[model samples]
Target: MKKIILPLMVVLFTACKEKNEKREVSFPEEKTVETPKDTLTKALEEEPALLSLDDVADTTFVRLRDYNRDFVYDMKYATDDNFLKTKVYDCAECYVRAKTAKALIAANEELMGQGYRIKFFDCYRPHDVQKKMWKIVPNPQYVADPAKGSIHNKGGAVDITLVDTDGNELEMGTGFDFFGKEAHHDYTGHPDEVLKNRKLLKETMEKHGFWSIRTEWWHYNLTSASNGKVANFRWDCE
Candidate 1:
């Protein structure tokens, strides 16, 4: 009887010990995550959309009849055979430029009854092409370096002038990107007509969601939002 009772007790103790040792597995505690709070995490400020001349439904291509109040004397970087007619123009190459095929068409329609047109001196300047321009004059005083980049590369900037109905360029004190006192807006030595013309250009572009850069009278940007990231892309024109 004693031997049987002791064996039973030993078996009971072993079962109890094994049961005590068995612990329920636990998972790690959850960690708290934080979100950034500020403008850095927010979307960029957007300007009001300018009217586009080419409706989404339109498949046909139209020529740019003029830039600005049509000055019979306006000029362009390239003629029809050499230039592109894309919606964005040479944006992959240069900073956002003005007078995009779309933008030019819109501006023309707006100024139609006024007897004005658009002309482009420089558009869709490529980064490599900008390098060439800088190489010609390593001075940042005139051209922004290829290393630094220009607003024109963004496809939302433009250097423009006005032309009259007769195709005469409205006289500005100096040509585009001219680095001299002649280009200064306050240079009263220039003719009043030139100053008025510059102001007109600024007002027109500003009304259409563009801002004139202080240094270059004709230089304008489509706000910071439109400037976007300058695409480091190689285009066929480049």
Candidate 2:
């Protein structure tokens, strides 16, 4: 019995030692490797600089395309699709004063939260273009007098409508520049959908430092820009 007990004890000790050795071999001590920090720096360096209105002057005219790409454009005077039946503008471009652009961008941000965005039919009409439009229509209700100068000539007014995320235009009772009583804000002859659409546009614009005339539902002017001087600076088409 002594001889058998001694051999069993020896066997158990050997087995325990081997198990401990295996455990040590399975998991070696982890090394401290230095990670490269340049990866984050490289990523930031590769990113494009963001645009902002901070550096722009309030009176300076800015191309809206440079600041925001979400706004849609149909540039009426650039084509013969307007009441004039003549293309008076050399090109289709949306320009506005820096302050006006800031307001527009803010208004668009709010509208986007509601699944809508502003689509511009006209913006920042040059004084020369206003004169050309006057020559064609000569209607005070439709086009502002060149001598008096429009808010558009001052880079403050925009002819716009709302569109859903899918790009379908909201029904505003009439098309842009519709010269009739039906387009008036007081006109309640439209369907509920049209009235709601126009109300949304008017309320949103007015909330963002803009004011609308009673006669035109599409026209909105930045109240702060009303005092700006008329401009004739034409944007390059290219």
Candidate 3:
């Protein structure tokens, strides 16, 4: 039987080693996400002119769903009920982020040469859509309550990470949605290569105007994410 899946909620950056691979550092796992009910509305009321994913004029969300590959551990993209409108994303900001990221990581040709690509776990989530994330995980300490809003609603914060040209997921310390201390970035004593790779990912993204949240290695917010914001907008995954 053929099967398809979306990346489960990818988690923070950290380090680890396989049977033969060396170790490195990873992101820490602190718990608890309290989202506000009217957070998006408040943000929108405050910055009515702010640009959101909805504002992007031209964008295309490449459908990973169509690809038949072994690399994706689709957790975020999966659904108990085959979800509709869950494939397309507001692609403008993403494109900008990716383009800028490309320039920032230009010096590190190794990553580029290997065709390391970024796959987003969550992006431009609406307060309502966040409900889906929380339901999927249901861990209040890690996943926020959908009744409350998420940063993703802002169309700024995106959870992502590196995959090879072949779409193979690289080993980061922990699996996505792991609510544990091993995910912590400061957690050391692993191999050096993993740590270095994590750093490479972080530094490169930041160089291009992306800011990493302290808790999530794969998560980043664009500097312009908040430019002319809109809120309480309907959230659709596709």
Maximum-lDDT candidate: 2
Which residue pairs come into collision in candidate 2?
A: none
In candidate 3, what are the lDDT values of residues 45-153, reduced to their tens digit? 5643423333333222222222211113333544332133243333322222322223323423445565676655555555555665566667656666755555555
Tens digit per residue, CA lDDT, model 1, 78-197: 432222211223332222232354554565566555676555665445566566556656787777776758766555566677777766777988876566777775677877888888
Clashes of 2: 0
Taking the candidates one at a time, how many backbone clashes does each contain?
A: 36, 0, 37
Model 1, global lDDT: 0.56
Candidate 2, 1-238: lDDT as tens digits: 9999999999999999999888844567799998877864575556555478899999999998777777888999899998888899998999999999999999999999999999999999999989998998898877889999999999999999999998899999899878899989999999999999999999999999999999999999999999999999889987
Report the poorest 10 consecutive residues by lDDT, candidate 3: 62-71
Report every candidate's CA lDDT: 0.56, 0.91, 0.51
Is candidate 2 or 3 superior in TM-score? 2
- The candidates, ranked best first by TM-score, are 2, 1, 3
Instruction: Kindly report the root-mean-square deviation of model 2 from the true structure over all alpha carbons.
Output: 8.1
Error of 3 at 59 (Å): 12
Off by over 4 Å in 2: 1-50
Q: CA RMSD for every model?
A: 20.8, 8.1, 28.9
Full ranking by lDDT: 2, 1, 3
